[model samples]
Target: MIAPARIRIFVDFWNFSLSLRREDDAFMLDWKPVAGVMVAEASQLLGAPVIYEAMHVYGSYDPAKPADGKFRNWFTTWLDKLPGVHTVMLERQKKRNHITCPQCHGEVKDCPHCHADLRGTEEKGIDTRMATDLVSLAWSNAYDVAIIVSSDRDFVPVADFLQSKGIKVIHAAFPPAGSQLSQRCWGNFNVINLMDKFRR
Candidate 1:
């Protein structure tokens, strides 16, 4: 008898942006339900363990801290933490942080050119590198495939290099691929299409 295979899976908190961009330019924040479903389905299809870098609410400048005014140092999204109703969401970001690597980790002041929060003007794709380094560490072990769910082209180089190293990119996009994404794929799958079928 042969053993079954296990692939590693990861999701981008930012992938939802492309999904919404499929229909509109603005990013949607309430795709939680959609994202949750995407995770379960991807794992089953790929036969792998999956990871979801916690959701983040940052772009351009910290909305809580406007430019023309005083700097909000506390970085507290909530006005108060009395009941602690939303502490989990707040703490998830408050706990850990990263420097100039647009990691899906916590937010920080960086440069856009280097994913740095410098001057507070880093566009989304400008600074982010994938948070899959831990997964890569695991790769030092033994894994056959790695699946990443994101549409950000910044990951193109990383994905290309991984493929070069014999890793399979299950480039899972939410809204489907535009020309920018299709050009760099050995294979691609859309979770939107998967969910439509999975729900049935």
Candidate 2:
């Protein structure tokens, strides 16, 4: 009998979570069951029992934001109880960028009447951190198969690299708009379609 593949899962938390919300506002995710289904599906695809190696979820949280910080803490605590699941939280770095009117191309620092600052806050480093971890794990021979639960095209290059190294990279994505990462991966699965089977 052929040996089962060792599989590791990498999830870009914010990207995957927000994408799911965008895809179906009524949808809710239950991670443990989702992981189980993913492992089962991957095992079937490989035609052998698949071993669950590790599942890493990456994201950032801002402590200054009470609501976000509270949720992050609670969510990470829940994730900690799940087998083989690890959560990596980074401090959310905020940058203030001026917003401009599309037609006028003029800085809109504040609403003339409302006096509200038109500054936009952007989160940085999440994608870079995820990519670094993905490559580092591949170099360390962490798993024979890597399942990525994200739809970001930024991961396309990493997927290509893993494939070149003979590592099976599988893209698990939502529908309506699949990603370039899926196209570059050795195989792909529609996560949205499978959500019902794993829904809490």
Candidate 3:
């Protein structure tokens, strides 16, 4: 009997979550079943049975923000508990913006309009981490197929590289957004249509 294809899922958490919220804010994701769903869809496209290996979810939280702390808790205490699911939480790097006051032509330290702190956090190294894992895992012969669950076009190069190595990369795409990445991938499935199945 032929061995089933091993599938690994990689998710860019913020990109996936924000996109989902844009489509339907009320939708709550049930994470555990996600691997099964992707595997089933990919199996049909590959014309072969695939087994779920694991899912690696990458996210970032602002260390200075209370709301982010709550999010971190949910990520570490809750999401990390799910079987076969691994989570990597990174600290967001503060953004440095030098805003010049139009009236005085001097650097504005705070928001001139709302008087709020102009500094904010931005995700750094998350994409690099995801890309590294994708390649390293493939090199390790960890999985036969990879299902990338983000619309980030930055993944296009990695997808191309993986395909060159005889590994199939499936893009779990949001229609019309990830066309570039999808086109480079071996296969793609519309994640929007499957959103309902992930709702809590």
Candidate 4:
């Protein structure tokens, strides 16, 4: 008897926000729901076992803003609008957005701030980090193909490397821009209809 085909897919959790927005930590941290939705969709198509890993986050800011109150207000409002969080939380954050970034790791400071160390794989770049995770899953497991959704340049290396391994890399990049990751990944690009994939 022949064994079923194998496939693996990895998604960058944080990158989904290029389109969506978050208002508070409550909904922002509860992203497992979103991941579970993707996993279900993928399982229906792949017809094989699948595993998902949480994506790494590496955010870049204008830097000119020095955590000042005015700067904080602008940054928070824009961010809250982007992920497009729920109206309740959106309105809350738009009116009052405060974040503190002390050296402490888990302690939730009344004022929350994000300080990017600019190291580690994800720190290098979020797209690169997601690609790396995809490649890691692909090589370690017995996957026939790997599906990804990103348009960041850092993933170029990951795509090249995955192709070298004879693993199919499919892009889930949407419209306006398609698989900006590079010629490598875009060549295999397969855009999913955002309208169908998103909530109204």
lDDT scores in order: 0.45, 0.81, 0.91, 0.46
CA lDDT, candidate 4, residue 159: 75
TM-score: the better of candidates 1 and 4? 1
Best by lDDT: 3
Estimate candidate 3's alpha-carbon lDDT, on a 0 to 1 scale: 0.91
Rank by lDDT (best first): 3, 2, 4, 1
The prediction achieving the highest TM-score against the true structure is 3
lDDT of 4 by residue, 1-200 (tens): 54544444455434445533332223233332443455454555655655553322234333333554454454346433433221111111121223334664443333325654322221224454455567666767646565565555566677778878876565555444544653575244333332234443
lDDT of 2 at 87: 83
Candidate 1, residues 1-200: lDDT per residue as tens digits?
A: 53443344444433444565554465333332544454455556656565543322222223434541222222234311212111111111221334444567554565557873344222343224333441453468444444556666766776677678776555666544543554575556566554443231
How far off is residue 92 in model 2, in Å? Answer: 3.0
lDDT of 2: 0.81
| Deviation of model 2 at 127, angstroms | 1.4
In model 3, the worst 10-residue window by lDDT is 93-102
Q: Give lDDT tens digits, candidate 2, residues 1-200.
A: 87778999898888788887887888788887767888887877777778899888887787667898787886689886699988888777546667777999988788789997656456677778888888898899888999998887888888888889999988887755556777788888888778788666
Question: TM-score of every model?
Answer: 0.46, 0.89, 0.92, 0.44
